[model samples]
Target: GAGVSQSPSNKVTEKGKDVELRCDPISGHTALYWYRQSLGQGLEFLIYFQGNSAPDKSGLPSDRFSAERTGGSVSTLTIQRTQQEDSAVYLCASSLARSGETQYFGPGTRLLVL
Candidate 1:
């Protein structure tokens, strides 16, 4: 991977539908993070994966939202039973360091839960 990027840049789905978002991080980046931006809601951390260590999933809004990073490369965010409130932009970033480093962000996946 060269730059951080997300798939399905825009998506529209009916309520209760399930959507899967994908993110590809930069090569050689050792840390990755996911974030969500919504109307009225600033920025919220969703999760983080550092190297081969266990991912920090505490930021996930609920059980309906889940993610996974494979082989320290690409990562996917799955949102089950999408709702109108779930309409937002999902962003992914990768850094060369675990913390306090420049993290390149993806363009983001715009998901619209109608």
Candidate 2:
């Protein structure tokens, strides 16, 4: 019955540091997705995982960005060598299936790189 949860609702980090953002999806949810949205910008898909299929990381901006889902529930986005451009809201969403389903979002983990 729990909704998605993200930690450190806000993160302030110096440029070039590595940061890990955590996500806890609702129970029994088999599809999860990560998206980044800059101020006033539309959501940019970063990565997604559905059941046992390989994750779709095509939208990951660069090699510095990566994510992993464990036990088919929790996921973490790790940004290596953080940059000022990476300052944005990292949102996590999940649904019962991968297609045609509304994604319920977390409050979001806002990253501010300085």
Candidate 3:
């Protein structure tokens, strides 16, 4: 893909259900990130993977929120036991190298938990 892309542009799930959000980053990007944007709020960092290093998951809000990047390209974010508070736009971004580099964003996945 020319840029990052995410699956299921919109998702609606009931409380306590689980959902998986996928992200396909640019071919050569070495850093991938996941973020959450609540209504009317700024982007909140969720997790990020850099090269072969351990992913920085310090930003994930809870154990229910987890993500993984495989083969250094595609990533998946899984939210378990979804809650209404978790309803938001889940965004994915990729950068050429480290965390501070400029990132290319994908169309976000809007998750609505009812």
Candidate 4:
């Protein structure tokens, strides 16, 4: 892809449902990441994957949140049994390197749990 792309820019779901958000990162990038931005909140790191390195999943809020990157390109974030507090923008970013370089962000998947 030319840039980071995320699907279902807006999602509305009832509590306790499951949702899957997708992300397509820029071509040739080696680092991919997922973050959450709640209303009036700062960007919170969720996970990060670098080429052949162990994925960093320390920021996931709970076990209900999970993600994976296949072939170092596309990635998916799955949220299970969602709750009202889960309503927020799920953003995906990618960088050319894994040393905290500047990250390009996707439009984001907006999840609304009511």
What's each prediction's clash count?
A: 0, 0, 0, 0
Q: Which candidate would rank higher by TM-score, 1 or 4?
A: 1
Of the pair 3 and 4, which is ahead by TM-score? 3
What does candidate 4's lDDT look like per residue over 41-99, in tens digits?
Answer: 67899999998889999999999999988888999999999999999999999999946
Task: Kindly report which residue stretches of model 3 are placed more than 4 angstroms away from their true locations once superposed.
Answer: none
Model 1 agreement with the true structure over 20-84: per-residue lDDT tens digits? 99999998898999999998787899999998788999999999999999888999999999989
CA error at residue 102 for candidate 2, angstroms: 1.5
Error of 4 at 103 (Å): 0.4
- Per-residue error (Å), model 1, residue 85: 0.5
| Candidate 1 Cα deviation (angstroms), residue 87 | 0.5
For 1-114, candidate 2 gives per-residue lDDT tens digits of 788999879999999999999999988889999999997667899999998899999999999999999989999999999999999999999998846988899999999999
Instruction: Count clashing residue pairs in model 4.
Output: 0
TM-score of every prediction relative to native: 0.95, 0.95, 0.94, 0.94
Looking at candidate 1, what is the lDDT of residue 37? 98
Name the TM-score of candidate 4. 0.94
